[model samples]
Target: MWSTCSLARPPKQHPYENRGCLLNDDVSNLGKVLEATKQTLFSLDTGYVSLNRILCLFEVWKTFEAKSPSGLCVLMLDVAELFNTFDISLANATQPADMERIPREIEENIGSVQLNLRLKDALVTSADHKASNRHGPGKDT
Candidate 1:
Protein backbone atom coordinates (compact mmCIF):
# COMPACT_ATOMS: atom_id res chain seq x y z
CA MET A 1 0.00 0.00 0.00
CA TRP A 2 1.29 3.48 -0.90
CA SER A 3 1.33 6.18 1.78
CA THR A 4 2.44 9.78 2.01
CA CYS A 5 4.26 11.50 4.84
CA SER A 6 2.06 13.81 6.87
CA LEU A 7 3.27 16.82 8.83
CA ALA A 8 1.69 18.39 11.86
CA ARG A 9 2.35 22.09 12.16
CA PRO A 10 1.82 24.22 15.23
CA PRO A 11 -0.74 26.97 14.91
CA LYS A 12 0.95 30.38 14.72
CA GLN A 13 -1.18 31.70 17.59
CA HIS A 14 -0.27 28.82 19.86
CA PRO A 15 3.01 27.88 21.54
CA TYR A 16 4.86 25.00 19.93
CA GLU A 17 4.48 21.62 21.51
CA ASN A 18 5.90 18.26 20.42
CA ARG A 19 2.56 16.70 19.71
CA GLY A 20 2.55 13.09 18.67
CA CYS A 21 1.78 12.54 14.97
CA LEU A 22 -1.10 10.51 13.62
CA LEU A 23 -0.62 8.50 10.39
CA ASN A 24 -4.07 7.51 9.21
CA ASP A 25 -4.37 8.45 5.53
CA ASP A 26 -8.15 8.19 5.66
CA VAL A 27 -8.16 11.19 7.98
CA SER A 28 -6.50 13.27 5.29
CA ASN A 29 -8.99 12.06 2.70
CA LEU A 30 -11.74 12.76 5.18
CA GLY A 31 -10.61 16.37 5.39
CA LYS A 32 -10.86 16.72 1.62
CA VAL A 33 -14.31 15.15 1.61
CA LEU A 34 -15.35 17.52 4.37
CA GLU A 35 -14.12 20.51 2.35
CA ALA A 36 -15.86 19.34 -0.80
CA THR A 37 -18.99 18.82 1.23
CA LYS A 38 -18.69 22.35 2.61
CA GLN A 39 -18.27 23.78 -0.87
CA THR A 40 -21.22 21.78 -2.14
CA LEU A 41 -23.40 23.07 0.69
CA PHE A 42 -22.18 26.60 0.07
CA SER A 43 -22.91 26.40 -3.64
CA LEU A 44 -26.54 25.53 -2.97
CA ASP A 45 -29.12 28.26 -2.26
CA THR A 46 -29.51 27.20 1.35
CA GLY A 47 -27.30 29.04 3.84
CA TYR A 48 -23.87 27.49 3.99
CA VAL A 49 -23.08 25.83 7.30
CA SER A 50 -19.83 24.33 8.48
CA LEU A 51 -18.70 23.48 11.97
CA ASN A 52 -16.15 26.25 12.38
CA ARG A 53 -18.21 28.80 10.44
CA ILE A 54 -21.27 28.06 12.55
CA LEU A 55 -19.18 28.30 15.72
CA CYS A 56 -17.82 31.67 14.62
CA LEU A 57 -21.34 32.87 13.85
CA PHE A 58 -22.54 31.79 17.26
CA GLU A 59 -19.64 33.61 18.92
CA VAL A 60 -20.54 36.82 17.15
CA TRP A 61 -24.27 36.43 17.79
CA LYS A 62 -23.61 35.90 21.51
CA THR A 63 -22.04 39.34 21.89
CA PHE A 64 -25.34 41.11 21.14
CA GLU A 65 -27.41 38.96 23.46
CA ALA A 66 -27.92 40.20 27.01
CA LYS A 67 -28.14 36.80 28.63
CA SER A 68 -27.50 33.17 27.88
CA PRO A 69 -30.56 31.01 27.39
CA SER A 70 -32.07 29.69 30.62
CA GLY A 71 -33.94 26.89 28.91
CA LEU A 72 -33.25 24.89 25.74
CA CYS A 73 -30.39 26.00 23.54
CA VAL A 74 -29.14 24.63 20.26
CA LEU A 75 -25.78 22.91 20.34
CA MET A 76 -23.48 22.16 17.44
CA LEU A 77 -21.88 18.76 17.50
CA ASP A 78 -18.63 17.52 16.03
CA VAL A 79 -18.94 14.21 14.24
CA ALA A 80 -15.74 14.33 12.20
CA GLU A 81 -14.21 11.51 14.14
CA LEU A 82 -17.20 9.35 13.30
CA PHE A 83 -15.92 9.02 9.76
CA ASN A 84 -12.79 7.37 11.04
CA THR A 85 -14.46 5.31 13.76
CA PHE A 86 -17.75 4.13 12.31
CA ASP A 87 -18.31 1.32 9.88
CA ILE A 88 -18.79 2.19 6.22
CA SER A 89 -22.01 0.16 6.25
CA LEU A 90 -23.57 2.77 8.50
CA ALA A 91 -22.79 5.42 5.89
CA ASN A 92 -23.89 3.17 3.05
CA ALA A 93 -27.30 2.91 4.59
CA THR A 94 -27.82 6.67 4.41
CA GLN A 95 -25.66 7.76 1.45
CA PRO A 96 -27.26 7.77 -1.98
CA ALA A 97 -25.75 5.85 -4.87
CA ASP A 98 -25.15 9.03 -6.84
CA MET A 99 -22.93 10.24 -4.02
CA GLU A 100 -20.86 7.08 -3.86
CA ARG A 101 -18.13 8.41 -6.14
CA ILE A 102 -16.80 10.98 -3.68
CA PRO A 103 -16.17 8.40 -0.99
CA ARG A 104 -14.56 6.20 -3.58
CA GLU A 105 -12.34 9.09 -4.63
CA ILE A 106 -11.47 9.70 -1.00
CA GLU A 107 -10.51 6.07 -0.51
CA GLU A 108 -8.46 6.20 -3.70
CA ASN A 109 -6.64 9.39 -2.69
CA ILE A 110 -6.13 8.53 0.95
CA GLY A 111 -2.39 9.09 1.20
CA SER A 112 -2.39 11.91 -1.36
CA VAL A 113 -5.05 14.11 0.25
CA GLN A 114 -4.07 17.44 1.76
CA LEU A 115 -6.04 18.78 4.67
CA ASN A 116 -7.45 22.28 4.12
CA LEU A 117 -7.75 24.44 7.24
CA ARG A 118 -6.75 27.82 5.86
CA LEU A 119 -9.72 28.17 3.50
CA LYS A 120 -12.25 27.57 6.23
CA ASP A 121 -10.33 29.82 8.62
CA ALA A 122 -10.22 32.58 6.04
CA LEU A 123 -13.95 32.33 5.41
CA VAL A 124 -14.76 32.71 9.08
CA THR A 125 -12.10 35.35 9.79
CA SER A 126 -12.95 37.42 6.74
CA ALA A 127 -16.64 37.39 7.54
CA ASP A 128 -15.86 38.54 11.07
CA HIS A 129 -13.53 41.27 9.81
CA LYS A 130 -16.04 42.47 7.24
CA ALA A 131 -18.79 42.64 9.84
CA SER A 132 -16.61 44.59 12.30
CA ASN A 133 -15.22 46.92 9.65
CA ARG A 134 -18.70 47.84 8.46
CA HIS A 135 -20.09 48.34 11.98
CA GLY A 136 -18.64 51.81 12.62
CA PRO A 137 -18.34 52.98 9.01
CA GLY A 138 -20.96 55.10 7.24
CA LYS A 139 -22.13 52.24 5.06
CA ASP A 140 -25.67 51.41 4.02
CA THR A 141 -27.17 48.71 6.19
Candidate 2:
Protein backbone atom coordinates (compact mmCIF):
# COMPACT_ATOMS: atom_id res chain seq x y z
CA MET A 1 0.00 0.00 0.00
CA TRP A 2 1.08 3.65 -0.61
CA SER A 3 0.24 6.92 1.20
CA THR A 4 0.07 10.51 -0.11
CA CYS A 5 1.38 13.46 1.92
CA SER A 6 0.31 17.14 1.75
CA LEU A 7 2.69 20.10 2.13
CA ALA A 8 3.36 21.10 5.74
CA ARG A 9 3.62 24.86 4.87
CA PRO A 10 2.32 26.86 1.88
CA PRO A 11 4.81 28.79 -0.32
CA LYS A 12 4.91 32.60 0.17
CA GLN A 13 4.75 33.31 -3.57
CA HIS A 14 3.06 31.61 -6.55
CA PRO A 15 4.27 28.11 -7.36
CA TYR A 16 5.63 29.47 -10.71
CA GLU A 17 8.24 31.52 -8.73
CA ASN A 18 9.60 28.42 -6.95
CA ARG A 19 12.75 27.65 -9.01
CA GLY A 20 11.14 25.02 -11.28
CA CYS A 21 7.42 24.18 -11.06
CA LEU A 22 5.20 21.72 -12.90
CA LEU A 23 1.72 22.87 -13.89
CA ASN A 24 -0.73 20.89 -15.96
CA ASP A 25 -2.54 23.12 -18.49
CA ASP A 26 -3.90 23.01 -22.09
CA VAL A 27 -1.00 24.54 -24.12
CA SER A 28 -2.90 23.65 -27.34
CA ASN A 29 -5.01 26.78 -26.77
CA LEU A 30 -1.78 28.92 -27.35
CA GLY A 31 -2.01 28.47 -31.15
CA LYS A 32 -2.52 32.27 -31.73
CA VAL A 33 0.48 33.16 -29.55
CA LEU A 34 2.60 30.53 -31.31
CA GLU A 35 1.50 31.78 -34.74
CA ALA A 36 2.39 35.39 -33.83
CA THR A 37 5.79 34.29 -32.51
CA LYS A 38 6.44 32.34 -35.74
CA GLN A 39 5.49 35.38 -37.85
CA THR A 40 7.93 37.56 -35.89
CA LEU A 41 10.69 34.97 -36.41
CA PHE A 42 9.88 34.69 -40.15
CA SER A 43 9.91 38.49 -40.56
CA LEU A 44 13.41 38.64 -39.08
CA ASP A 45 14.56 35.83 -41.42
CA THR A 46 13.06 37.57 -44.48
CA GLY A 47 14.71 40.84 -43.46
CA TYR A 48 18.10 39.10 -43.47
CA VAL A 49 17.40 37.61 -46.92
CA SER A 50 16.49 41.06 -48.27
CA LEU A 51 19.63 42.60 -46.76
CA ASN A 52 21.76 39.83 -48.33
CA ARG A 53 20.13 40.35 -51.71
CA ILE A 54 20.80 44.08 -51.47
CA LEU A 55 24.47 43.43 -50.63
CA CYS A 56 24.78 41.04 -53.58
CA LEU A 57 23.33 43.64 -55.90
CA PHE A 58 25.67 46.30 -54.50
CA GLU A 59 28.69 44.03 -55.04
CA VAL A 60 27.58 43.35 -58.60
CA TRP A 61 27.39 47.09 -59.26
CA LYS A 62 30.69 47.81 -57.51
CA THR A 63 32.69 45.09 -59.29
CA PHE A 64 31.13 45.82 -62.71
CA GLU A 65 31.93 42.15 -63.42
CA ALA A 66 28.29 41.37 -62.70
CA LYS A 67 27.84 40.16 -66.29
CA SER A 68 31.30 38.56 -66.49
CA PRO A 69 32.20 35.08 -65.19
CA SER A 70 35.28 36.62 -63.50
CA GLY A 71 32.97 38.94 -61.50
CA LEU A 72 31.10 35.97 -60.06
CA CYS A 73 34.41 34.24 -59.30
CA VAL A 74 35.71 37.31 -57.44
CA LEU A 75 32.43 37.69 -55.52
CA MET A 76 32.60 34.04 -54.36
CA LEU A 77 36.14 34.68 -53.06
CA ASP A 78 34.97 37.62 -50.91
CA VAL A 79 35.36 35.57 -47.73
CA ALA A 80 36.09 36.68 -44.19
CA GLU A 81 39.75 37.80 -43.86
CA LEU A 82 40.44 37.02 -47.54
CA PHE A 83 43.11 39.75 -47.68
CA ASN A 84 44.47 39.05 -44.20
CA THR A 85 47.97 38.42 -45.63
CA PHE A 86 47.87 41.49 -47.93
CA ASP A 87 50.87 43.84 -47.67
CA ILE A 88 49.70 46.94 -45.79
CA SER A 89 52.31 49.21 -47.45
CA LEU A 90 51.21 48.17 -50.93
CA ALA A 91 47.57 48.57 -49.95
CA ASN A 92 48.24 52.09 -48.60
CA ALA A 93 50.29 53.08 -51.66
CA THR A 94 47.58 51.98 -54.07
CA GLN A 95 44.60 53.30 -52.06
CA PRO A 96 46.21 56.49 -50.56
CA ALA A 97 43.65 56.80 -47.75
CA ASP A 98 43.86 57.21 -43.97
CA MET A 99 45.41 54.23 -42.16
CA GLU A 100 41.94 53.77 -40.71
CA ARG A 101 38.94 53.31 -43.06
CA ILE A 102 40.69 52.50 -46.35
CA PRO A 103 37.78 52.79 -48.78
CA ARG A 104 36.19 49.68 -50.34
CA GLU A 105 36.83 51.47 -53.67
CA ILE A 106 40.59 51.17 -53.03
CA GLU A 107 40.37 47.60 -51.67
CA GLU A 108 38.68 46.40 -54.87
CA ASN A 109 41.57 47.66 -57.06
CA ILE A 110 44.73 46.47 -55.19
CA GLY A 111 46.99 45.30 -58.04
CA SER A 112 48.93 42.00 -58.03
CA VAL A 113 47.47 40.05 -55.10
CA GLN A 114 49.96 37.63 -53.53
CA LEU A 115 49.33 33.89 -53.73
CA ASN A 116 50.27 31.38 -50.97
CA LEU A 117 53.33 30.17 -52.89
CA ARG A 118 55.19 29.18 -49.69
CA LEU A 119 52.28 26.91 -48.70
CA LYS A 120 52.21 25.40 -52.20
CA ASP A 121 55.98 24.74 -52.06
CA ALA A 122 55.63 23.23 -48.58
CA LEU A 123 52.90 20.86 -49.78
CA VAL A 124 55.02 19.80 -52.79
CA THR A 125 58.07 19.20 -50.56
CA SER A 126 55.99 17.20 -48.05
CA ALA A 127 54.61 15.02 -50.87
CA ASP A 128 58.14 14.44 -52.21
CA HIS A 129 59.42 13.55 -48.71
CA LYS A 130 56.58 10.99 -48.26
CA ALA A 131 57.29 9.47 -51.69
CA SER A 132 61.04 9.18 -50.99
CA ASN A 133 60.43 7.76 -47.50
CA ARG A 134 58.16 5.03 -48.94
CA HIS A 135 61.15 3.71 -51.08
CA GLY A 136 63.03 2.99 -47.80
CA PRO A 137 66.88 3.13 -47.08
CA GLY A 138 69.05 0.93 -49.38
CA LYS A 139 66.73 -2.06 -49.48
CA ASP A 140 66.30 -4.36 -52.54
CA THR A 141 63.53 -6.40 -50.87
Candidate 3:
Protein backbone atom coordinates (compact mmCIF):
# COMPACT_ATOMS: atom_id res chain seq x y z
CA MET A 1 0.00 0.00 0.00
CA TRP A 2 1.12 3.52 -0.71
CA SER A 3 2.04 5.26 2.55
CA THR A 4 0.72 8.51 1.14
CA CYS A 5 -0.76 9.81 -2.06
CA SER A 6 -1.46 13.39 -3.13
CA LEU A 7 -3.58 14.97 -5.86
CA ALA A 8 -2.47 18.30 -7.18
CA ARG A 9 -5.43 20.35 -8.33
CA PRO A 10 -5.69 23.39 -10.59
CA PRO A 11 -3.87 21.51 -13.36
CA LYS A 12 -2.77 24.19 -15.81
CA GLN A 13 -0.73 26.24 -13.33
CA HIS A 14 1.22 23.11 -12.41
CA PRO A 15 0.62 21.10 -15.54
CA TYR A 16 3.53 18.67 -15.29
CA GLU A 17 3.13 17.91 -11.60
CA ASN A 18 -0.62 17.37 -11.41
CA ARG A 19 -0.57 13.69 -12.52
CA GLY A 20 -2.12 11.64 -9.66
CA CYS A 21 -0.11 9.18 -7.64
CA LEU A 22 -1.36 5.65 -6.90
CA LEU A 23 -0.02 2.70 -4.94
CA ASN A 24 2.26 0.29 -6.82
CA ASP A 25 -0.26 -2.51 -6.38
CA ASP A 26 -3.02 -0.23 -7.68
CA VAL A 27 -1.07 0.73 -10.77
CA SER A 28 -3.89 -0.75 -12.86
CA ASN A 29 -5.78 2.49 -12.20
CA LEU A 30 -3.38 4.24 -14.59
CA GLY A 31 -4.92 2.38 -17.52
CA LYS A 32 -8.39 3.49 -16.46
CA VAL A 33 -7.22 7.07 -16.17
CA LEU A 34 -5.62 6.84 -19.60
CA GLU A 35 -8.82 5.46 -21.13
CA ALA A 36 -10.84 8.24 -19.52
CA THR A 37 -8.44 10.82 -20.91
CA LYS A 38 -8.79 9.33 -24.38
CA GLN A 39 -12.59 9.32 -24.19
CA THR A 40 -12.65 12.91 -22.96
CA LEU A 41 -10.28 14.14 -25.66
CA PHE A 42 -11.94 12.19 -28.49
CA SER A 43 -15.54 12.94 -27.46
CA LEU A 44 -17.29 14.67 -30.37
CA ASP A 45 -19.32 16.69 -27.85
CA THR A 46 -16.08 18.39 -26.73
CA GLY A 47 -15.58 19.73 -30.29
CA TYR A 48 -11.86 19.95 -29.69
CA VAL A 49 -9.08 17.94 -31.35
CA SER A 50 -5.42 18.01 -30.55
CA LEU A 51 -2.74 17.56 -33.23
CA ASN A 52 -1.28 14.70 -31.18
CA ARG A 53 -4.64 12.91 -31.24
CA ILE A 54 -4.89 13.38 -34.99
CA LEU A 55 -1.38 12.00 -35.50
CA CYS A 56 -2.17 9.02 -33.29
CA LEU A 57 -5.27 8.27 -35.36
CA PHE A 58 -3.25 8.56 -38.56
CA GLU A 59 -0.57 6.25 -37.15
CA VAL A 60 -3.17 3.60 -36.37
CA TRP A 61 -4.52 3.85 -39.90
CA LYS A 62 -1.01 3.72 -41.32
CA THR A 63 -0.39 0.36 -39.64
CA PHE A 64 -3.23 -1.19 -41.58
CA GLU A 65 -2.30 0.61 -44.80
CA ALA A 66 1.35 -0.39 -44.46
CA LYS A 67 0.55 -4.01 -45.40
CA SER A 68 -0.11 -2.84 -48.97
CA PRO A 69 1.94 -0.42 -50.97
CA SER A 70 0.22 2.89 -51.82
CA GLY A 71 2.11 2.87 -55.16
CA LEU A 72 3.36 6.44 -54.69
CA CYS A 73 7.05 6.90 -55.48
CA VAL A 74 9.04 8.42 -52.65
CA LEU A 75 12.63 9.65 -52.88
CA MET A 76 14.48 10.54 -49.70
CA LEU A 77 17.75 12.37 -50.39
CA ASP A 78 20.10 13.23 -47.58
CA VAL A 79 22.73 15.38 -49.29
CA ALA A 80 22.31 18.49 -47.20
CA GLU A 81 25.84 18.12 -45.82
CA LEU A 82 27.32 18.14 -49.36
CA PHE A 83 26.02 21.60 -50.28
CA ASN A 84 29.48 22.76 -51.33
CA THR A 85 29.84 19.92 -53.84
CA PHE A 86 26.60 20.72 -55.71
CA ASP A 87 26.60 20.49 -59.50
CA ILE A 88 24.55 23.49 -60.65
CA SER A 89 24.84 22.61 -64.31
CA LEU A 90 23.37 19.15 -63.72
CA ALA A 91 20.55 20.51 -61.57
CA ASN A 92 19.73 23.18 -64.17
CA ALA A 93 19.52 20.52 -66.86
CA THR A 94 17.61 18.09 -64.68
CA GLN A 95 14.34 16.84 -66.18
CA PRO A 96 12.49 15.85 -63.05
CA ALA A 97 9.59 13.39 -63.25
CA ASP A 98 6.70 15.23 -61.59
CA MET A 99 5.24 12.34 -59.65
CA GLU A 100 5.03 14.63 -56.62
CA ARG A 101 3.54 18.07 -56.13
CA ILE A 102 6.67 20.09 -55.34
CA PRO A 103 8.65 18.68 -58.24
CA ARG A 104 5.72 19.27 -60.60
CA GLU A 105 5.47 22.90 -59.53
CA ILE A 106 9.21 23.44 -59.91
CA GLU A 107 9.31 21.85 -63.39
CA GLU A 108 6.29 23.88 -64.51
CA ASN A 109 7.82 27.17 -63.37
CA ILE A 110 11.61 26.77 -63.64
CA GLY A 111 12.04 27.14 -67.42
CA SER A 112 9.04 28.89 -68.92
CA VAL A 113 9.78 31.37 -71.73
CA GLN A 114 6.58 33.11 -70.61
CA LEU A 115 8.20 34.07 -67.29
CA ASN A 116 8.98 37.79 -66.79
CA LEU A 117 12.37 38.61 -68.34
CA ARG A 118 13.57 40.27 -65.12
CA LEU A 119 12.68 37.24 -63.07
CA LYS A 120 14.40 35.01 -65.64
CA ASP A 121 17.54 37.09 -65.34
CA ALA A 122 17.34 36.89 -61.54
CA LEU A 123 17.00 33.11 -61.73
CA VAL A 124 20.06 32.91 -63.92
CA THR A 125 22.10 35.10 -61.58
CA SER A 126 21.03 33.26 -58.43
CA ALA A 127 21.51 29.76 -59.81
CA ASP A 128 23.94 27.77 -57.68
CA HIS A 129 25.61 24.44 -58.33
CA LYS A 130 23.89 21.39 -56.84
CA ALA A 131 26.00 18.40 -55.78
CA SER A 132 25.79 15.22 -57.78
CA ASN A 133 23.96 12.32 -56.16
CA ARG A 134 26.53 9.80 -57.39
CA HIS A 135 30.20 9.46 -56.32
CA GLY A 136 29.62 9.94 -52.58
CA PRO A 137 32.25 8.81 -50.03
CA GLY A 138 30.69 5.39 -49.38
CA LYS A 139 31.70 2.27 -51.30
CA ASP A 140 29.80 1.90 -54.55
CA THR A 141 26.88 -0.47 -54.26
Q: What is the TM-score of each candidate against the true structure?
A: 0.24, 0.19, 0.14
32-138 in candidate 2: lDDT tens per residue? 23333211111112122211222222222222221221222121212223224422223221111222232343245532221122222322444455457667787
- For model 3, name the residue pairs that clash: 86-130, 86-131, 87-130, 87-131, 88-129, 88-130
Candidate 2's C-alpha runs over 4 A off are 1-115, 138-141
Q: What is the C-alpha lDDT of each candidate?
A: 0.28, 0.26, 0.24
Please list all clashing residue pairs in model 1, or write none if there are none: none
Error of 1 at 114 (Å): 5.0
lDDT of 3: 0.24
Question: Where does candidate 2 have its weakest 10-residue lDDT segment?
Answer: 1-10
RMSD (CA, Å), candidate 3 to true, equals 24.5
Q: Write down the TM-score for model 2.
A: 0.19
For candidate 3, lDDT tens digit of each residue in 1-141?
Answer: 111112212223323333422223333243333333211111111211211122222221222122211111112233233233322122221112211322233236432222222222322222321122343466363
Output the TM-score of candidate 3: 0.14
Candidate 3 error regions (>4 Å): 1-84, 87-99, 111-141
For TM-score, the strongest prediction is 1
Model 1 weakest lDDT span, ten residues long: 63-72
